[model samples]
Target: MQVFTQDDVLRFIYNEVDAKEKKSIEDALRLNPSLLTLYTELKEVVAKLGNAKMEPDNSTIDLIMAHSAASKMETSH
Candidate 1:
């Protein structure tokens, strides 16, 4: 009867747990409503994060390129 923590649930969500721990968590999830709710919420968050897009804007990219070109010119001289 191991009490799973939020960290344990997170590892389970990411498939970082071993087979035995995975089975235990699955069993707990079936019998414990609270754990199941946590799992569901965390899983949704993980899914949303997976779908999230993050990239530098065009201005940031242009700034980086400009800096790189300036550095290259300084070195070549």
Candidate 2:
């Protein structure tokens, strides 16, 4: 039985863990109250992010492109 740390729980919640580790984390989640609470909060955040509709406006994109072009020119020089 592996005792997962907070980082491990976070990785599991974010789908960053491997299948084997995910199974381990899932088993721990079932019996750990604190991990369950943390998972719930992180899951809610992920859900909210998934529902988010964010798009940069044309002006913002232009500014970013201009900055990128300038940086490239500076590096090339």
Candidate 3:
């Protein structure tokens, strides 16, 4: 039996694991309470990340652009 580590869990969550490894993890998830909990938590996090918008809103973008323009003006003078 291969020992699953954090990296393996992450890979499984991301669908980066090979078919055999994925099957192994899926099997473990059924029998191991702790692994199931970890998988559930990771799935939630991944779902949240999928819905997350990291880009700054228009107002913030405007503020940053204005600040950048101001800095350029100060440096050129």
Candidate 4:
């Protein structure tokens, strides 16, 4: 079995990769216990972060929108 890459971890999280790849990641994790634990811990932290609510800054949002619009126009041209 080959060593797993960070991309595999991301794909495992998102379920975007094939079963063969998923199984490969699992097999790699079986050999590297630390990675397996890190994966589980980080996923739990991310889940909690997602569940936690935070207020968005209106000014920051407007600035981001303006910048995105400007970038889009530049790209389209």
Task: Sort every candidate by TM-score, greatest first.
Answer: 1, 2, 3, 4
**All candidates: CA RMSD (Å):** 3.3, 3.9, 4.6, 6.5
| Full candidate order by lDDT, most accurate first | 1, 2, 3, 4
TM-score, model 1 to reference: 0.65
Candidate 1 Cα lDDT to native: 0.95
Per-model TM against the reference: 0.65, 0.64, 0.63, 0.55
Task: Report, for every candidate in turn, its global Cα lDDT versus the true structure.
Answer: 0.95, 0.89, 0.89, 0.82
Residue-level lDDT tens digits of model 2 in 1-77: 67888888888877899999999899999999998898898889888899778888999999999999999999999
- What digit string (tens of lDDT, one per residue) describes model 1 on residues 1-77? 88999899999999999999999999999998999999999999889998778898999999999999999999999
Q: Model 3, 1-77: lDDT tens per residue?
A: 66788778889999999999999998988888888898899899889889767776899989999999999999999
Predicted structure 3: lDDT: 0.89
Put down candidate 4 lDDT per residue, 1-77, tens digits, no spaces.
Answer: 58776667767877887988888888878889877887787678778888879888999999999999999999999
Model 2 stretches with alpha carbons more than 4 Å out? 56-77
